[model samples]
Target: MTTERQFQHDSQGPLRRIVSSVFSIFETRLELIGIELSEEKERLIGVLFLGLAAMMLTMMALITLTVLIAIAFWGTYRWQSLAAITAVYVLVAIVCALRARAGLSNAPNVFESTLAEFKKDRDTFN
Candidate 1:
């Protein structure tokens, strides 16, 4: 009767409310993480595919141009032409490698949003 109702009400008091709020927070954070993960996956796949295609086409062009240059200079400066091409390729490759290394260091954190959200929640609770 009255005591039973009080018991039920007390059971659903601040502690229960706090637990429910925490669970809701966790649910929201989990949903955000899942959405971010999907977006990251899509972005990574697109970059990978596009990079591979570009590399393949550029390689073909390079081979064709190299052969054409060698053939054009066959009589006189053939060896010098090949040597110049080799040196230029080495320099370009070095520059590309350095730029890629720089890019890796500057790459954005994948979980930055998640961590930011978590920090916001913490600040709010504090």
Candidate 2:
């Protein structure tokens, strides 16, 4: 009876340790995931503000330049200048769309590090 009890205790001890270790590893991964999410959020917010600012400034400059160009050619090549500006804008729009598509395709996957860590853990366990 004592030997059976001792064997049971020994068995429970290693099993408990294994469970605890697994949980600890999972907890660590969860914390890393949280940190990655936070960093991603901050990055996106910063990008949003910066992008908005740049877009606003660019629009203001374009508007001012367009008005100036139109006014200068008002009595001469008014229609021609307008057409030229429209053509330029169309071409720019096309280029910007292409570049944006390329950028999206090339951008790194979000939560890359977390996914990598999970893969490493899986490999380690395996």
**Clashing residue pairs, backbone N/CA/C < 3 A, model 1:** none
| Global CA lDDT computed for model 1 | 0.94
Q: How many steric clashes does model 2 contain? A: 0
C-alpha TM-scores of all predictions: 0.89, 0.93
Candidate 1's residue-wise lDDT over 83-126, tens digit each?
Answer: 99999899998999999999999999988898998999999899
| Clashes (N, CA, C under 3 Å) per candidate | 0, 0
Give Cα-based local distance difference scores for all models. 0.94, 0.93
Q: List candidate 1 segments past 4 Å from native.
A: 1-12
Highest lDDT against the true fold, candidate:
1
Query: Candidate 2 residues 1-126, lDDT tens each?
Result: 999999999999999999999999889989998998899999999999999999899989988999999999999999999999989989998999999899989999887888898899899989
